[model samples]
Target: MSDNQQPAKNHVTLLLLSVMLLGAALVFAVAADAPHTLVLTAAGLGLSFSRRTPLSRTTRSYVYAGVSVLAATVLQDQIFPVDTQRFYLIDGRYYAPAVIFLGIAITFFEQRDTTLTSVISLALIGTMIAGNSGATIVTNPRFPMTNGLLDYFHFFYGCVVAVQMLAMLAVLPHVDRRVRLPAPGRAWRWHRATVFWVSVFGVAGTVVGLRVAAIHYERLADRTFRDLFRVYMRRQSERMIFGYEVDLWRTVPPRTRADKTPVVRALAAQAPGYLRGRAFVRYGRGTWSSSDTGEHLPPTRPGGRYAYSVFRRALAGRTPSATPPPAPRPATIDLLPATAYPLGGLLAPGNAVEFELIADGLNNSNEGALVPREWDVAGGYSLALDDSIRDTAYQGPAEPPTEAERYLDIPGHIKEDVARVANTVFGATPPRPGTQGRLAQLSRFFEAGFTYELGVKFDPAGKDPILQFVEQRRGHCELFAATTVLLLRAQGIPARYVTGFVCGERPPSGTYWVARLEDAHAWTEAYVAEENRWVLVENTPASGFPTTDSASGVVSRAFDRLLVAWQNLLAQVKRGYVAEVIVALFLGLCRGLGRLLTHPLWGPVAVLSLGSAVWWLWQRRRRRRLAAADRLLVPTRTELQKTLGVLEKQARRFGVERQPCNTIRELARRLESAAQGPLRDALLELLREYETLRYQGTPPAVEAVAEFKAKVRRRLAAPG
Candidate 1:
């Protein structure tokens, strides 16, 4: 080689060495947590090419880089099967090297810059950004997404990736740099042809390897996961944390952010009857969230219980003869909550209810496993599930579905400053003997510094919004919920972000109420038991809502009365159905027995029967008269006045009751003589509204009436 060419060759050699070193670093970092075989192969391939000669310096560098990437990918596939984990770049050994080498090849070898190149580069960058974005920070323990290390890393990595791509473009020649070959004699050309064919074969092999990878991913992605089903005997549930290491599954495209894509809509459709996975009472938004630990047993019997059966809301409506065979009786199903919701998808085991799915019974519907029954399990259940359904399918298998690990991915471009905050919050050590104490510490840390604020515009200006929120502590529930999942996951909890109404209502008239957009809430759920069951904990402050008083302000507290009514009604309804069946059977039996008794062989029985019928009619008429009188009886105005007088007389005994037309302030003043401070204040506001509606001018708003009903329901339902 010419001396001038030697310089270029040396430069390429140095570049190849840099690739090998970087690959080794990533392998070392990732292998400690999740080891991959690809690192060894990548190292060997790069070393092999270090001493080999190619037709030209340019060809040598490009081929060596390509081979290194291909080798690394093969190694990754061998060790970290898609079955075990999702496609996370840093978590898996091969992805980083593959991406890095590809970047190096595009940057160093190809010196041509065209519109196509720019377009391709932009496409890759966009995917990286999309993949790495949507992090949360939880200084306040209110949101872990903001506080977690991985999310910060994701944003940081994404930015790094973008910068690398841009830097590559800047370094590559803006104009075509393709080299031309001089014509040779026929005899010499034959030797050149043989070399060219060998090169082609190598390229073909590389392409085939990539094709095989694509096929493998396709199959893995299509496999259906198992749905967890069982009833827990206690609070502790056992489960395998499937997506703990990867964040890829949490990837939500910008286009799908607004509407209920298959996932969101699936959860929304089951809203009212859906048994919530956990309840976090602390967040500002009014709802139940799954972000912390709860007592294994219901402190009291779980209230607000609703029976859910997935009924097809808008089916294809096949005619009777053509309808599919009753959906195979929901034998085993995987249930997953929408990614948009705050609580992680809940998996239940034991006493599992028989399910009636809303869509075609397929796991791909993203409606996770529907666990039947009302009992709480201490640990998770063990069951085998068929892995044939895609996330799009809504049916088959009662096994805990494998969560996509991509959801845990941290992009390569997040700003460094955000990570600084994570280090401070999460600290160097993993928190605790358990998940709850760590979360409590995190919540307290955030509450001390951050103020919950909504409707603020985020400035992405190369800095991650999560990082900014950590520093500023002002954003909507989306930020809070995301942060909860991120931080908890960082603490080694299998957490998922969720967005949904915290709590809502059905009026006395049984109409479903639409929570205002302001009612949107976010939270997190962590996998606790083997059945993949989850519990909810809250870290929100008291003043997150708009009631006259903070204690009296919660929508759930306001509707506690109605919730009781609903539960009681449900239990009663179940009994009523049994009663109806019993009565029908009893009447049928009586008629049959009477017929047998009056047969021709026993004609005398006819006379007895006629007498019995006469007596029965007489008794029925007498009972009707008594019931008629009872129905017609009504309280007179005097009686109502007497009732009011009695109420006034016994107000103290029945508990505190404010007078009609009394303002909360007035009630407080009157109670000053006998009232305690905070509790008195809360009751004053609650009763103030009640007094006004019962005795003042216009009736309360439907909202107030509903609120009143809920309170009454709770009180009546409370155990003495």
Candidate 2:
């Protein structure tokens, strides 16, 4: 390759590497939600290669800038379709393309003059901020300051600034060095001015265009763009389905084909049967809604007497005299990693008397939901619960109160159909006139008649879902539970729909149960007025419950165990418990060593040994130093004499041999006169330094003596 072409090639290579690194970082960071990051990265590489084409520098900069803006505009329309009402600017998928294309554009212009590049960079930053704002406002009704806008701004700007700075640092050093020439005429200056203004205007136009496109796409560029940007927001309750919509009216469950997706990794001394989650008391057209609006109970302080009293009262029930009921039994529940939402799940059946431990921000409780004030938390807590109460009929008043009215809510349309089914199954005259008998009969009826199947599809425009499930005799756990709840409510037995995970395989460790996504289930919780507490009634057939039998191979089980270990590690990190343990162990070891060393006999022996070792080390280091100094001092004498002899022989060829009676400095002057040039100067300096070091008590520095010797050797070796 030619000399000129090599550096240019290197510059392009470096630029490409930087761009790729930046692109890869972005892709991996957000690719799970936004795959288009890869496409933009590839396009950026293509633009970088085109820099080799025969085009003016100015023209190339403009071309790249224009292409970048066009790419951003196109991507905005493609990723954010007009039909979607909600736009999550925080979603990397929405803003990745714009950032990638603009970054590439900034890199291209970075090789140009400072003023133009700076302007382009500023324009890019402004464009990004404006586009983000426009997209945020269009998709969300809230003002700019709310919902993590400040954090988003800091993050977005930080990324843009970092990428731009990296690109500039990579390319600026390789900019072509222009030869000094006469100043250009006024017309040339004017042409330059015009190009600058044009670039400015072009960037402004692109920014405006991007904002417009993001706010509302006039026409989608292609079907891929349309499909790629299509927004499908899943409700928070559908997390078990892994972001897929779970239409209540649909026959098939949303997430039926199961792989091993862990729902909870728990370790306890005993198996906690089920971890219950959100419950809905109202049912309408196959949908379940919770409308209890229960008062939020403040979390009791951990160790206070008031806290203990509250827990004691809740667990013991209203004691006639407050003679202090016996302490409740405590069970340790460890929530491993992989569990989502630290609070919303039933720890144990009875009232939680006291929490052994809890993660920060998890201090709120509702009727059946225990959640943190904030959404982000990872560890779990052990609690003391009164597990003595069995799931029996309530002995309280049979009359329903205003609070119980919500559980009896069934849609008017399905009321008659559900009541007819209930009467047919349990008999119209109440064989046993209590809630427990009716619940048991209903459960038995559904388990006998309905077949538990994961894959069942119903027509969108068909009969009521409950009616269809009853007639078809086939559905998943959701359908069975929904039907059971509706039937119970229709028969005036207050019931609610409950969602949670059933216990899965017991690991060989035999400590805790592992609950996977497939274990997620829905069941009916009938309110037993007699007991003043809800009782779980399993209406779903046995076939639907998850089992750890040989169907799941060794690999799946191993993966689950690995997940549990990983979660434990994360919990330790968050609580700093691992660090504390390490520190404690280190201190303990130090204390033990100190105690051992303080013994009179061992202490004297140790001191003597340590002193002997220190003395030996000092002697050894002193010997090495003396040896090094001797080598430095002795080598100079022999090497200098040999070098002078070589120089004398070379001088003899010029008939200027040194005399033994003459001083070295005097001899050097004679040699210089014979061979007058750089060779003469080197010989003089070398001889003068040699005389000073040989005679004077003060020896020259090791480096100076070595340098003088090298000069003498070079002069001698030259062609005479």
Against the unseen true structure, what C-alpha lDDT does each candidate score? 0.39, 0.54
- Score every model by TM-score: 0.29, 0.49
TM-score of 2: 0.49
Index of the highest-lDDT prediction: 2
Candidate 1 deviant stretches above 4 angstroms: 1-404, 415-418, 429-437, 460-463, 501-520, 527-537, 545-583, 586-603, 606-608, 611-720
Tell me how far candidate 2 lies from the true structure as C-alpha RMSD in angstroms: 15.7
Give per-residue CA lDDT, model 2, range 216-269, as digits (tens). Answer: 754555555556545322223444332111246855545644645566666765
Model 1 lDDT per residue over 410-433, tens place: 334442443455556667665444
Predicted structure 1: clash tally: 115
